[model samples]
Target: MKILGLIVEYNPFHNGHLYHLEKSIKETNATHTIAIMSGNFLQRGEPALFDKYTRAYAAVKNGVDLVIELPTMFACQSAEIFSHGAIATLNSLNCVDSICFGSEEGDVNILKTISEILVDEPNEFKIYLKKYLDDGMLFPTARSLALFDYINKYNLLDISKEKLLDILNSSNNILGLEYIKSILKLKSNIKPYTITRVQSQYNSETIESNICSATAIRKQLKDFTNIDSISSVVPCNTFNTLKDKINNNFDPMFDDNYFEILSSIIVRDINILNTYFEVNEGIENKIYQSIFTSSSLDDLKESIKSKRYTMTKVKRTLNNILLGITKYDMNNIKNIDSIPYIRILAFNDKGREIIKNIKNNSDVNIINKFSNISFSKDDKIFKTLIDYDIKASNIYNLIYYKNNRNLLKGPMDFYISPKYVK
Candidate 1:
């Protein structure tokens, strides 16, 4: 039985996502699809529009066979760490045969080439990169210039520098390439595949196509009460789900309240801001200055923005601060060879069989409930952090209604018939 693995943060399950899921399975001839998804917070350092459980349920209802939560640490990090963590989780399953991701340039060779270059940074390239950084250019711009210089030095013209620069700008494709690098780094046998993204640009904020970017859809949802505006863009089921949620006055998991808490945490711990993940070269001092002056998350981000640190990077730093994840914890987690355990989020009949097979052949524990599991000291610390995240999510839920005030606990089972099977 072939199994296809996907790394996703279906902040909200939309039509484009459903299309990717179906096409990936068809192209790979896989019997089952497994997803390592972001929990409450996503890579952008923002809270997921929906909670992880709801998103998992939505995936199961659409087409996915099984879903596992990506630890908050990796889910909230940069592209490289995010890819590394997702790949590590899927590899630990010991059943995933291939990993599929969406890319603008669907050519596997180009992605592989980029991955190799990044993995083995040449001395000349490093020198150039350092020179550009020293000149006060941001890291992304410096890296792009360095890569362009490398291309010119090698007399390589088959791939345009403009094209390569575009790839570097595209965060998703860059991460997709990182996933390939990680597989090679681990000597894993998982094959790589890419599905060309359609209609929606990853970073676009306008809903122009039927397949709209999550950012555009989310922005619309904040101001409009009707789902009809995005009806053509999202899956019917997802549309209906959002409608019901709105009617019930249920706010998305990541709400303004969550950001407020994040802001408060940053302000209160201004002295220890550098202790969080990715805080370097006096970034913490900048954050302290911003927190005291800025009123909202967006304002704080703008106040602290610099040429070297992007908005996304600042948001991720805020996430670490809110979760109390220190620099030492980040180092420790990065060294983990495999996921500590598989905490099942949702599974169907085929997924159940997969779990049975895992138990028969693997030594990794499969956990379905919080009470059934005991954590080591390190694991306990991680769990406590996760619980804090959950509380943050619940606090956002409170914005909708007083009755919707409780922290979610344990793994949730969301059973639904697969479209193909049904």
Candidate 2:
């Protein structure tokens, strides 16, 4: 069984996602396909356009055989850690033979070369990196400039600095490089494949006719004034599901209410802000100053963001704070082996066969039922992990109406069972 593993956050199952799924299967000759997807929260430190279950079901209905949740810790982090956890989870399955991801460059060799450079971190690169950091540039920008400097200094691969910048700056290519770096770090046997991204771009916010980006689709969803053109980009499954959600008044999450609600939560526990993961460089103090003054998430993030900490970092820190994920809790589980468990989200008939095989083959625990395993009273690490997952779910539900909040209890998310979809 040549199982293909995919790292995804199908914030909504759109046309681009469907295209990638089809191309992945054909390109890899995969017998089974599995996705380790983000749950209700995304790497951007915002709630997914829709809930995980709906998104997972849409994935399976489209092409994915099985869907598993990427834990909250990794899901709401930067690209490097997010890719690390995703690669780790895919590797844990043991039965997976290859992983396929979309990339801007779309060349496996080019992606591999970049990953090698990142992993090796030549002395020249480090010196350049340090020089930029010392100049007070943010880590990402500093890293970018350092890459350019190192490429120029060594003339590595005879590739121009400007050309390399184009590849590195592309969002999917950055993730693709990190994915390769993680695989190299693990010395894993899984093969990697990259498919060229098509049509709309990663950050494009306008809906095109046939191949719009998810970000574009989201913009249309956010403004329901004219949605007729959305069908051109999203599949019937996604379109219908979104329509159902909209008709039921569940489409207001992107509105200002989320930050309004979050503000109330932040004010209630301002003193404990520093304890959460990613709250550093006195960012907690800035958040404190903004919590009472800022009216929206944008306003709060604007107040907290600085030259050292990017806007994404500030938002990610807020996500950590909202869910009570302490830095101590994260530090205790930095080792890849410390990722305690994996939660199955949804699966089709083919997925059931894979699950049966996984029981005998997987490295990590395959959680289908919540009650089967519980962290003992003394296991703070595991408890803290599960605690954040539950808390994140509860907060994600805040986007829905009051009565619909808390739809899934702690056990339901962690213990009850993975949803079986035909």
TM-score of each: 0.87, 0.90
In model 2, what is the error at residue 181, expressed in angstroms?
A: 1.4
Worst 10 residues of 2 by lDDT: 407-416
Model 2 per-residue lDDT tens digits across residues 368-406: 766655744256655666667777777777555455545
Q: Which predicted model would earn the best TM-score?
A: 2
Local distance difference test values of all predictions, in order? 0.75, 0.79
User: Given candidate 2, what's the lDDT at residue 17?
Assistant: 90
Best by lDDT: 2
Q: Give the alpha carbon lDDT tens digit for every residue of 135-250 in model 1.
A: 99989899988877876888644577789888877867888888998987777888999988888888877888788788888887667746678788888777776777666666
lDDT of 1: 0.75
In candidate 1, position 41 carries an lDDT of: 76
